[model samples]
Target: MKEKVVAINRVAKVVKGGRRFSFSAIVVVGDGNGTVGYGLGKANEVTDAIAKGIDDAKKNLVKVPLYKHTVPHVMEGKYSGGFVLVQPAAAGTGVIAGGAMRAVFESAGIKDVLAKSKGSSNPHNVVKATFDALLKMRDPMQIAQQRGITLSQVFNG
Candidate 1:
């Protein structure tokens, strides 16, 4: 699986002796074939935190519906203070997004898309919002089936 480290934060806690420091990592992982997941892990060391994150992400893997190297339709997602809007783009447009969102897209094997994150720049919230948007995506064929119509009828109508 391919993995991207979206953020690593050094957190400190006050103790009797002094300040104790730990590392927190947020990571995204994928098979580069429409499966992706995100996780957050904290540990005393960066490498350990990253490893834990990868394991957690693998457990949360989700399959994304892809069409022509992009999302099938427009989507909006929100998590706490973060909001994200994702839409399909032309084949050659490439992934147009910011830091946290880029990692999620690349991991999900999205080659073309237009995404915007608003309300908060925090990686954690942005990633969650992006996931929400992706989880809500529905392929046209799936929609047609759910509506008891043929795929062609959906687009034709």
Candidate 2:
């Protein structure tokens, strides 16, 4: 598996003597075979922040349903003020997402998808929203089983 640093920000806190500076990093990890996760880390050093983020991401992993290099269906996810809409795309469409959404899709091994982010643009919120959407995805087989129907019945009947 490999990890990608999606975003990093330098944060500061005012103190008695001066401002204390720290780094916050968002990281995405993936095997390019369907497994993926994201994490946020804060530290005094950029390297440390990224390392922590990777560790956090590994602890929070989700499995996504992939179909022909895209998601199985269209869905919407919301977190706080962040809203995200994800749709499956043609094989060659590539990832049509920006900022945090793009990172999430790439890490999830989704080669083709269309995503739109609305409301708050905060990276944390956006990332969480994307994950929420992905988690809601249901595989066709799972859906069939839940409904007490066989796969063949679904497609042919």
Candidate 3:
């Protein structure tokens, strides 16, 4: 598994010594095999922030069901003021996403997906919304089981 830093922000706090500066980072981690996660970390240094972010991401890992390099159906997720729409794409269409969403798709090993972020452009909110959508995904077999029906029955009926 590997981790990627999606964004880094510098924050400052007013103190007796004028200001104290810190770093905040957004990180995505994955095995490129249907598992992915994201995290936010704050620290006094860049390296520390990134390391913390990766560690946090590992703790929040999520499994994404892949269907021929794409999702099985279209879905939407929302967090705060951020909204994300995700849809399956044909082979060779490639991943159509931007910023945090792109990092998420790549980390999840999604080769063909169409995604758009709406409303808020904040990286934190966007990442959260993307994860929300991925977590909402349901596998066909799981759905069939929940319905007490066979896979073939699901397709035929």
Q: Pick the TM-score winner.
A: 1
Query: Model 3: per-residue lDDT, tens digit, 42-123?
Result: 9999999999999999999989988888987899999999999999999999999988999999998999999999999999
How big is the RMSD of model 2?
A: 1.3
Clashing pairs in 3: none
Backbone clashes, candidate 1: 0
Higher-ranked by TM-score: 1 or 3: 1
Poorly placed runs, candidate 1 (over 4 Å) = none
lDDT of 3: 0.92
Candidate 1 scores a C-alpha RMSD against the true structure in Å of 0.6
State the number of backbone clashes in model 3.
Answer: 0
Q: Write the per-residue lDDT of candidate 1 for residues 25-134, one digit (tens) a residue.
A: 99999988899999999999999999999999999999999988999999999999999999999989999999999999999999999999999999999999999999
Q: Which stretches of candidate 3 lie over 4 Å from their true place?
A: none
Q: What is the descending TM-score order?
A: 1, 3, 2
Estimate the TM-score of every prediction. 0.98, 0.94, 0.95
Model 2 residue pairs with clashes: none
Clashes of each: 0, 0, 0
**Model with the higher lDDT, candidate 1 or 2:** 1
